[model samples]
Target chain A: MADVPSMEALEALLRRLPGIGPRSAQRICYDLLVRKRNLLPQLATALERAHAAVRFCERCNNLSEAPLCAVCKGLHRDHSLLCIVESPADLRAIEDTGMFSGDYFVLMGHLSPLDGVGPEALHLDRLSERLAEADLQEVIFATNPTLEGEATAQFLADLVPAGITISRIAHGVPVGGELEYVDRGTLGRALHGRRLLDE
Target chain B: MADVPSMEALEALLRRLPGIGPRSAQRICYDLLVRKRNLLPQLATALERAHAAVRFCERCNNLSEAPLCAVCKGLHRDHSLLCIVESPADLRAIEDTGMFSGDYFVLMGHLSPLDGVGPEALHLDRLSERLAEADLQEVIFATNPTLEGEATAQFLADLVPAGITISRIAHGVPVGGELEYVDRGTLGRALHGRRLLDE
Candidate 1:
């Protein structure tokens, strides 16, 4: 059945979200419009609040309400170690592990030649300046292991000035993965990077 | 990384929607905040518009901006046939099939004793009044084929006054479903309602 104009507009906007298809969008629109009372107002208010408050971090380009992101502003986080990631979601994923205590630099996206997105588009010049200003001892490239991500990492590696250490996150079999189930490339990497127990 | 308060609030509201889990809600939040420029304003406007315009139809209880829903206001549709459904979504689903050209009555919900819902909660009194006023030839119970739906249908059948035909939608294996894959209840129903080839 055809939805009313406003419902149709809401559904259209919802469909633009990642992972939301036509059916789900329609359901969401109907839920907001009718099923759940007072939901639309809440959602609208939240959206407006976020739009008014959230902004990009001045240093890391991560999402923030203030000039600097929480990670950048936190006193205990390691300023000497910066983790470069493709998006804030990736940074959050790493943070969820509770293993990393370093600051971050969010690239927002990876370089893709087909999309005409290159170093200039990614603001590599600003990244270079940020690296020069910070007292960073190590920079970790935590971009996805996709081809475009690898190329972006390679480009950043080439751009690193002399003396400061640069590292890429290891690509190997998962911690609990069986060798038989792991892809050949990952298995090969795991074997190639094997270390002595004594060492 | 912890999201800012406004972003977190937006994500929370978004998660309340059907089919949106935490991950997709986060992605949608990020898309609205960063990926798509000016998305939040459009979504907010659409939501506000829908909230302001959409209202329950006075006659059939379906969503509409005006007093009467499109179906109730239509002159050409069968005024003598009224289909009763559990929700507006159900009404929309039936309309999409292009099979029924009758007016509708939305129950909004079925009788759930555990949830404190009953015939009164579903406005069965108003339904009786409407039925009395209309020159109805038939009343189709199009509620879902669940236990509660069945109970609700039964209650309505009992409520329907004499001299009016009452009907229920058939329940059996889905049109393209294989008998082997179909559930036992549906198979049983299909068998019980089997029709003659020439009839």
Candidate 2:
């Protein structure tokens, strides 16, 4: 099997992907080479096209084919309201909800000092520039409710001017989640953040 | 995100791979485009190179970079003893054991009537031709122990000429397996195939 250089090379590349172990890489390689032969060229072409075209949006840092992403370029979105998230995947999740019609700034990652990630790595300079330049009225922190995310949010909040309103997305039990199954940390947050309801 | 044609195309192509769902595809796409941007061209080149170089072995139907696979071209292996397997993965598994220095004929897939695979799909014509042309003394069925694998082995056994020894790999409790945990069917087979030990 090692004699097949091309196969081994492809398998090694596949192993580099997130969540792909050696066995899984081998299975995927076999499936592509044998079961779905047509996909080989299609995937290759797709990779090349994406490599050439896809880039970070100049305004929001989301994935874009051009300088500005759809949200950044769109006329209808509320530019005054900005939601900061960790990644494009998080932005996509917020977009899929259809509840928010505002601009987004993707951090690309959180502030993790242990793993060597910091404000510079997250492009906080660009974020601060946008905050200073844009006439934003409110900025919502939609980062994950983790220690690093909270630290990043607090760090970004300090950089914003005093006039703008700053807020964090609520931490509570998920809509369809069971209270019995909820962890103590989430339960505590839900209890602490409980809001009064109108009769 | 919809405006990013290349990104969507790459994600769609990735989704076609085995075990990749929509969310996983998006995650992988982002990981490639943003996190490991260097992997994009590398993976594309690997795919193109593998597609151009890899093809079925003319003799054994295994994946090969040339007309004949390494095993088929090797002089040290026993050509008179042929081991039949379902796919290149199975052949690789056997090869990893450092045992069975014999020639192999890869069926590529087992007979699946529901899925439209038959003797023709398994390339029985080539198998029969090899059986007739080669002065083989023994043939080992190394196919999986599943129902389809067993049927395929039995079907191929009938094609072998008389006086040629035919054998199936033993099914029994695995080396580290406990009797309490062994499945009933395997336990039954193990009992039935029990051999006499010399005192």
Q: Give all candidates' CA lDDT scores.
A: 0.86, 0.90
Identify the leading candidate in terms of DockQ. Answer: 2
- All candidates: TM-score: 0.95, 0.92
> B73-135, model 1: which lDDT tens digit per residue?
887898788899999888888988989998899999999998999778898878988788657
Q: Which stretches of model 2 miss by more than 4 angstroms?
A: A133-135, A179-181, A197-199, B133-135, B175-184, B196-199
Question: What fraction of the genuine interface contacts, i.e. the true contacts, does candidate 1 reproduce?
Answer: 0.75
DockQ of every predicted complex: 0.69, 0.76
The i-RMS of every model, in angstroms, reads 1.7, 0.9
Count steric clashes of candidate 1: 0
Candidate 1 docks at the CAPRI level of medium
Tens digits of per-residue lDDT, candidate 1, A1-199, equal: 3437777888898888899999999888777766785998888888888999999999888889889888888889887888899987788889889999988888989999999997877778778886885588888999999999999999898877788899999888898878789999888988898878998
Give the best candidate by lDDT. Answer: 2
lDDT of 2 by residue, B33-148 (tens): 88899999999999999889999899998888989998888889987888999998898889889999988999999998989998899988899987875669999999999999
